[model samples]
Target: MLKWILRRTTGKCELERICSSYPAGAERTRAVEYSLSKSKLAALKILLVSDGLNASDAANNIITLKGVDITRNEGFRPALLQCLRHISGYQKLVSEVTRLQKEKYSTAIDDHEQQLLKLWSLLKPARSRKTSKTKRVGELGFQGNDPATDFRGMGLLGLQNLVFFAENYNRSARKVLSESFHPKFGYSFAVVGINLTSLILELLCKEQLKSHFYNSVSGEPSLYHFHRVYCHVFCEFHDFWFAEEPESVMEFSRILELYKVHLLSRLTTPGMRLHSEFLAD
Candidate 1:
């Protein structure tokens, strides 16, 4: 709430960056590559001086602090080459591992259509929701919150089960429900609405998140992701949760609250707000 208001007040496109209320973990897959690059620059500087060549100004600036004559130090070349070689090998291994994991995930999802159907059936309708043959509301989104407790509570474990039966939610499932299942289950079907999608996508865009709120003794899933997927699935119902209390600008916090938003925290030109407004409709 605070972040949303700060973006609007400060006029930033951070609508995609600030709504994260969960933990997405360290996404630093490029850390090793960057470390390698820095190492290579330092090593090349040493090699240059060993052959009686001067370090480039840019390289010299870094070497000034390290106080190491990499070129003069013949012993380090083997270590540097070995490190470079190791980084290269690790990159290949990471790529292969990622590829295999993606394949396994695709296969698992591809094989579970009926299970998804069965679990989705668990979304019984509320009285106000329209009864159509679609999993969507014409305008309103999912309107129920006395969540269907027939399954395990709303957590990754719950979605894991759903995902277990989820055979490619990416395609025909949406199409088929967009076509047929809703007619049969529209009376029962509930789905997400735009506000929730925007919020979830916004959460995914955050550069950082404070996620201790998601910790549980069981280590089930991040609290933010849990609420996020819930919003994704049920935000389409009539009076869907987010719609029940639309976002409002906040300038102050209550006694028991600690909300903060920083629209200009890292801004180089505060006047960009006006420039952005000039170009935006």
Candidate 2:
């Protein structure tokens, strides 16, 4: 019989001391875990050195990493499915914000909002190379508003109807991002958006299957115990799905692949905001 003398922890981590026991042949499993953890740390170091991931970027990514893993848990099929949808919805919000911020498009959200309004434009293309007095044109419809051809139509009925839902997620990520601005802003965003988003996420998570369960209880749709991680990721996922993401959102997916199966997973790390890291620095 053999016993490991110490519990595992990162060498630089503040944690210290433990009793660790494993099956006789569990060395291989232990090795894989150690290797994976080391790799994550190594990636962080490499990114820090080469990517110039300053204190703020490092802090943001860490907070963001917590949000991204929600959809990766395959075990919690229902929650995972809902998160996937939220992620897609949120990505749309990302594009909107990014488009509004570019040097070429720097303006209020509504300014470019008007430019993109052309869902379909009337055209005058003809087979005749020679042009004379011409009769008026052909196909015409709004650009993004046209449900027939426009990818993002308009309203809930439009191609981009889901953007409305995604907007909630963007608001969620903004709270996380607000750590860069002010603690009050971050807290404010979190409280306001989560209160609303929790409802939205709860609905999205339960609408199909859970809704049936609710029908029997209150004679209306209701979720009994709310999901915390589901809401966190729904916010993070949907924000990434619709908002102006850089590399942070993509990074979270990579981390979630590390965990094993379960009913649904809670966030491995408690979420953080810029306020905490900013204070740390």
Candidate 3:
């Protein structure tokens, strides 16, 4: 309530008078309130001056400050409302994505393992062989034969990200998989995909993807949008790794740091976007 009062009030005297309501800490509160009030008064003075008022006249009274605020709010009403709507939609999207991230993968669910196999098949055509599940996972470029163990931290969401990329952007996913097999610059494709999932989840938790989503989405973004971002990160990081020509996968951490810097620079731009073609770059 005090913060709101500080935001709306315009004059030092008026603010000092209002602060007296908190009788419990009258002197201390008044001092704090006085400083806040002056800062706001200074901002309103600047706002008025920008609107062509002389500083002398702008600083004279609270009435001018209220008039300036009313006019400014009225002029920017639609835009402010739009911004609020997108923020609300973003909260919903983040909540749903976070919920999905927490859903642990279960082998008891027969369809889960089948989905994993289907995703692998999409990436590389395979004959019907009676290979064990562990070997099949190994063939998909996981560090170990038991990919379920690899999914321990990120749960089903990690698998979902890998599957989404392969299923939706088959060509790009295959290209990245091929790049991951480069003799001089090889990486474990499944492991790297899982790592990228963790990276993106960190970004989501930190709210660093807000600029990208706010600029790109018209209404509400979704779990699919989150997966699309993972796909982008996977392909782009793959391209970046080869382009840098590192000595080996030993430099994976260094290369990943560079990739993160690259991503953050792009994501912070005024109108950042990530389309399928953009990911191809």
The CA lDDT of each predicted structure is 0.29, 0.27, 0.66
Per residue, candidate 1 scores C-alpha lDDT tens digits across 1-281 of: 76458656754322112212212211111222233244535653343223222224423443354454555543333333322332333333333323332332111243333333343443321223322223342222223332222121222233332332223232322332343233322322223222222233233224121121122111222333433343323323222222323232121122001211222231223122111111111
Model 2 residue runs over 4 Å out of place are 1-173, 179-217, 222-232, 235-250, 256-281
TM-score of each: 0.24, 0.19, 0.69
Quote the lDDT for 89 in model 3: 49
- Predicted structure 1: clash tally: 14
Candidate 3 residues lying further than 4 Å off, grouped into runs, are 1-81, 129-132, 278-281
lDDT score of residue 171 within candidate 3: 81
The better candidate by lDDT, 1 or 3, is 3
Residue-by-residue lDDT tens digits, candidate 3, 174-204: 8888778888989889888888998998887
- Which portions of model 1 miss their true places by more than 4 Å? 1-112, 124-189, 193-198, 208-281
**Global lDDT of model 3:** 0.66
Instruction: Give the C-alpha lDDT of model 2.
Output: 0.27
Per model, how many backbone clashes are there? 14, 20, 0
Evaluated against the true structure, the overall lDDT of model 1 is 0.29
Winner on TM-score (2 vs 3): 3
